[model samples]
Target: MPDLHSIPYLVGAGIVLLHVIGILHVIHAIMTVRTSQGTIAWMVSLIAAPWIAVPIYWVAGRSRFSGYVRARRSDDAELLKLSDDMHRRLREYEIKPDDAFGRAAQFLGGLPFTRGNELTLLIDGEETFESIFKAIHAAEKYLLVNFFIVKNDRIGTRFKDALIARAKAGVQVYFLFDEIGSHRLSRSYLNEMKEAGIHCSHFGANRHWWSRLQINFRNHRKIVVADGKEGFIGGLNVGDEYLGRDQRFGAWRDTHLKLKGPSVQAIQLVFIEDWNWATDEVPDLEWTGQEHTADQVAAIIPTGPADPADSWQLVVAEAANSAQERLWIASPYFVPDGGVLTALQAAAIRGADVRILIPEKADHLLVWLSAFTYYEQTIPFGVKLYRFKKGFLHQKVILVDNKLACVSTANLDNRSFRLNFEISGLTPDPVFVGEVAEMLENDFGNSEPVKVSDFTARAFWFRLACRVARLMAPVQ
Candidate 1:
């Protein structure tokens, strides 16, 4: 009954439309894709197969986070003035030499390493939650809380209740969460927070339509800044698994840090910028100059796709490049980009002790499989890999040569390196570095050393699957 003769003409028209869309998308990819490999891959695919590639490009090709960038620039002049003022005030609190990380922070458009800060390493979830709750209860002036994932489970309810209590006590509470990461979060939960007087919003809630569809970019940072005096940042999120309640993960292991001093100011600034982008309203808080005693030196580096370059990625690479005695890293994921892998291999080849610690249990199948591909290439270069047996290892802590240490939410994978927003605290204090060293020592002790034979002895299909997973590394 259909027009059989018109089928050829209809097919020609569809082919023309697909080609037009594909060509336009190729130009867009060339203009927007951050990495050269990504651009070439998209261009070739778009030209080879128009229909399939065009849809895929629309969903995943974009790398820059234009929405947040626009929101950040809305009040550019005012923010610049404020930043200059803060820098002028921080000049007196700057630390002495042996602070290469301070220069790296400057490159990232962040504050320098300041003295007079006290740092406490919270080993796992129980200590982290306890310290955070106690700090929230002590909030008098203002409170800021942000996390990538905020579940409505046991720990999430506790976090919500703490904020509600503070809000009812006349404390100005500002809460931010990632809509994508917390997609399971209920509307009723958000309504309850609004009813309790907490100013809360999703990070990219009001983004442009096109940008909203590009959901790859995420605010993966977890932070809590209270009273402009203390702050917390690290890997643990507000969920029951983080507290080791989920039997699937068995006993969960992670790390967090609590800081009191000028370092808190640097962390608070990171929160303020994210808060401003989300709500487009600035809160009144203290920028008062406090006296310094030069107790400990630390800097906060916040990185995202909005930046001119990959600051957090460069941080990891530079640390690997600069290590002399040893380089130790523990992350839940280990899918490093070319630059980072090269840096680690070079570090090991140059006689530095290079060790990478990953979890025995995997939370993401693609990432877990892809990580094996790297083992074959790196193990021969004096790079040692270990797998934690106690439980999952989700900490993003790094120890560099017993002098520099980092703790943050940034993973070693491409997602944190380029896509997700991250905040890392860099410290050059030996005392703090020593603490990190001891913690990692215990972690490495419990972990089983991986041998090259492990992967070489795998089945044929298993090897093929690992290779296939590795092929998806750039996108994953």
Candidate 2:
């Protein structure tokens, strides 16, 4: 009754439809994808294996975040007014003779390097969480909170309780987290926050039906802004694992920063934009920031795929290019793009002390393996490599000579450079740089230098596997 003789015709039609969809996707990749390597890889896969590749491409191939872009543009008028007001308030404490990095940060992050800001480095989970809790408890007016992952564990529960108490006290509290990154966060956990009168939502790439299938882009920022007078940002998310409770990654290593003064206003703006996208309500926040006499000049740089260009990629290369003496970097992942790699090689050849420190124990196997493929090309150019043997190194830090230091949530991988929403605190203060230098010195003391023989002596099959993983770098 089902017309069994038409089976061959149905199969033929399906094949034709697949190719048609594949061809359309190929065109989309060529026109929309920003990276040439990504475009070519997707095109070939879509053409050769449409059945599997088409779905994957539809979900992950798009580079520009249309929803965020549109939301930002829609709020242009209010944001412009806010920017003007902030600049006016920050003008009295403005620092002159700002370096290229500072200037670029002002333009890109829409935040200027205002003086009179106090910055303190919080090392690892114990110190970072302690600082954050104290700051949250001190919140008098409002608090802006965002993270990539917010667990329901011990630390997370403490964090929730603190916020709930503050909300009950009538201090406006806004909490935002990424849906994909916090997929394990129980619904009851979110409901509890809502019941406690905390404004909570998830930032995600799901504004459109097509985007609902796309989970590649993530909000990887971890920020806390309290009363527009203090702020925090860095690599640590809300989880028990970050506190060294997880047996898998024992003694987790990370870094966070605490800022008090005008820079907090900039961090507050980032949360405002993200919250606007989540709730479409741009609530009024304090504009004027407290000033200090400290000589520290800092800027908050926020980058994402919605940007006209790859911002962090350019920043990475610039850090290498502008290094007068030393360029040190530490990241959990070490998959640099071609431009950044070339910049590092050139800097090393030009007599700069270029060092890249990565964790020996990896959470992502492919990224760990792919890093080996790059050693042979970089090490010969005087670029030093070190592997941190003390647990998993998850901090995103960069030190340039004695002038600049950065603590950020952006990794040295394609994902952070292209796909994720990331923020970094850049400072030209000698005090901050000295602290970072000391930290890196201790890190280097604990790490073991990687030699040329280490990579060269790998087994043939292992080398082959690394090479194959390296081929996936564009998408990784």
Cand. 1 TM to true fold: 0.96
Report the Cα lDDT for residue 190, model 1.
Answer: 88
- What tens-digit string does per-residue lDDT give for candidate 2 at 1-476? 44899988999999999999999999989999998888989989999999999988877888878778887877478876776787888888777535775566567666678788999999999999999999999999999999999999999999999999999999999999999899999989999999999999988633667666667888999999989988999999999989989898898889999998998888988888888777777768998888867757888889998788888888888889888799999999999989999999999999999999999997888999999988998999999999998888999999999999999999999998889999999998898999999999999998999987888898999999999999987667
- lDDT per model vs. reference: 0.86, 0.89
Off by over 4 Å in 2: none
lDDT of 1 at 49: 98
User: TM-score winner among the candidates?
Assistant: 2
Model 1 sits at a Cα RMSD from the real structure of: 1.7
TM-score computed on alpha carbons, candidate 2: 0.97
Q: Compared with the true structure, what per-residue lDDT tens digits does model 1 show for residues 164-214?
A: 999999999999999989999988888998999999999886677777777
Q: How many residue pairs clash in each candidate?
A: 0, 0
